[model samples]
Target: MTPRPLPTSPAPHRVVALLRPPQAPFPLACATEVFGDHGPAIPARYAFELCTEHPGPVRTGAGYDMVVTTGLEALERADTVLVPGWHQPPGTEAPPAVVAAIRAAHRGGARVVGLCSGAFLLAAAGLLDGRRAATHWARAAELATRFPQVRVDPAVLYVDHGDVATSAGSAAGVDLCLHLVSSDQGAAYAMRVARQLVMPPHREGCQLQYAELPTSGPVADSLAPLLEWLSGRLDQPVSVAEMAVRSQVSARTLTRRFSEQLGISPGRWLLDRRIAATRALLEETDLSVETIAGRVGLSSAVNLRRRFHEALRTTPAAYRRAFRAERAG
Candidate 1:
């Protein structure tokens, strides 16, 4: 028998999770389960640790104290800083030390993650300012009111800005964690993790179905082939009838399938996809609106601005400026 070579492992990604008093246990578990030990079956990919501002007993709000010995300094060496859930009253501000620590970690190049109410902490750190953030829908109004600078989109399950990420309440944390895994490792490895956790492969954040930067969730279907086709033709003119032709189905049938599976009409989905493309361009490129509009099939800057404002509540130029500032910061 031929000898087999041993598998090689990659560099460990250090994930330091922040623990404030009154932590929400479920979201903490979500982060720990995903980024913590992978057991004997899977090779270790991440180093998971916990920290607090005061570095002592932490309240779980579930009737138990979690004794954490590490302090905010733990974030100094982290590749990623995750705040699972901070259970504070609506108007309360995050501790100055904690906010400063998170801000320092982010400036030091660690990606910051906030799950559920943790978004409030990131906002206090100024990470979510001028960015589209996600949180528990119930608290969305409060978050918006408290942090007027943050663009809170409560309808989405999660929103990832590459450097900073936030998720909706509860299980949505799992989705965002899995998404981070996919982005860090690969879809195949993330799929293995999801299987270990007994979840679907992945689900597109379906609230928007086609919104800008919506996190991954269940891939809608029957329209899968059509969607794949449309992705390639985003730079060209595409109509419902043309899409039906490409899918080899009647326009009515396509519309029906979209409604049944995606909960949106075909036209709406297409427009949203274009808006999404526009947003991506605004973030990544310095392309003019006229150029971007043509690239995304909007045909003109005027039409693109109208649709972009309708979808995102911000003009293309302003969105670009805000994201540029975020990147610069």
Candidate 2:
């Protein structure tokens, strides 16, 4: 059957977020919060709507039911099509109709986006083949295992390829939506939307997931005291040798423990923590870059900028500006 032609709309853009049971509510909300009307405070740049495969009461991951009247037919009219998330049981496949509708939408010049587990559906629709995608870290391995043709980067917050995009779990979906707004309009307009939502306007898609941090338990017990001590003393110079000395283990043993417990070496873990602390200072304080560097143990603004850029793919000044704009907005 020939698909319906795209809608001729006077509205600036039409964004349709596709849902399927049991849908993930948070990602769906992320799309809506970004694209939904915010009164005159933020101009209506896009007309956002929701659609489902069967067009009835769809069960959500949160154990509630939401009635959606629109069907996959909505994809035919969308300027941008979003799949918030999909049923995530292992080895499950997207319904053929849903997959076909997504592909048809893309073919008709719609930009398609998948959030979190929704990447699986995009993969099923063959939209993600030969492209880098991002999803929740927990499901990255499964996504890769199931769709070998797709390049899945588990570390990133999101991946945007212009025609298609995918974001990591929950909050990262917000990041992706803000990115879409930025791309569609511009940084200033996107910042306005982000201000309404009380969220940071821009986070580089390449930033590593903070959720990748190690869990605490018996494995981390031996080093827990030292970890706490290090965290409180980020202003002081710290070395692996000092960490080993404090933990009463050899440097090699400390590194082994870190690898076994945290899946990273001691030095790497320390660096990550220092970087994380630096980010907090950047967001919450008005400290000069040099002062922040000294407080975070980086010693110099040049070194802090280099390490911050390496870790987040964005400069501290830019990050601070985005967050400050969010606050001012």
Candidate 3:
């Protein structure tokens, strides 16, 4: 089918999630949350639908079944095609017809998305041959090993390269959907959706899934005070020794507590908190890098950049530019 050029005029964008048998329910639900119903508070600007290769009831890994009459043909007319996580039985491949349909839709101008392991299907279709993509960190190695041509980033939540986008596991799918909403509509609309869902307005797609410092336990009795202190002193130099002193514990004891409860060291937790603060500053303020670094306890812009890149794979400037552009556009 010949696809029409994407309309430059702003309109209600259509997002179709192409599901397969035994699909990941979370990604599908995430797609629905961000695009499904806008209710009365938010203006209706998105048209979301669930489409499958063949019309009828599709089984989900979640042990339920859903009826979806829309088929692959709907994809040809879509502005965007979302492939949520796919369930490929061990040593099995996605149906070839599905792969062909995905390629045809993309070739016809619809933006293609692969959330989580759905990326495997997109990769198999040759859509991700030379582009950077991400999957669940657990599946990254397998995807890389199988599709040597695709650059797999196990660390990022998602990667957007204009026409094609790939996301990491589970909740990252939310981030990708929100991103598409932000890109197609604007940050204001995306934020409205996020607010409706009670999630962060935006998160750096590169944010780590785990803290460097592990929690010892729900020793809110002790940790609560520490967190409060840490939050208030984001600008100060915090050390394990200082934390231990304030907590009335020895450095060794505190380290043990962090390991048993948090899974990361106290120092790492502090750094992560600082990084989170830095990200907030980057998103919410126009502060200079030097100023942001000091405010986030990073001491220097150079240090902040290095840490930010290591954690997110994008520079602070690029991150801000992308988010700001999303906000404005």
Best by TM-score: 2
Better of 2 and 3 by lDDT: 2
Give candidate 1's total backbone clashes. Answer: 5
Give per-residue CA lDDT, model 2, range 28-54, as digits (tens): 999999999877666678999999888
The lDDT for every candidate, in the order shown, is 0.84, 0.87, 0.83
TM-score of each: 0.62, 0.68, 0.63
lDDT of 3 by residue, 1-329 (tens): 53332223357678889998887788888888888876777777878888888889999988999999988888878889989887776578778888889999899899999898989988988999988998988788789988899999888889998899999988888998898888877787778789889887887776644322222335657677887788899899988999999999999998888777766789888887887787778889999999999998899999999988877677888878877975875
lDDT of 1 by residue, 5-103 (tens): 223467889999999888789999999999989787667889999999888889897979999999999999999999998766755767888888899
Q: Sort by lDDT, best first: what order? A: 2, 1, 3
Candidate 2 off by > 4 Å: 1-16, 30-50, 53-55, 69-80, 90-101, 104-110, 134-160, 167-219, 248-250
lDDT of 1: 0.84
Question: Where does the lowest 10-residue lDDT sum fall in candidate 3?
Answer: 208-217
Clashes of each: 5, 0, 12
After superposition, which runs of candidate 3 have C-alpha atoms over 4 Å from their true positions? Answer: 1-10, 211-329
- For every candidate structure, what is the RMSD over all alpha carbons to the true structure, in angstroms? 14.8, 7.0, 9.6
lDDT of 1 at 66: 95
The better candidate by lDDT, 1 or 3, is 1
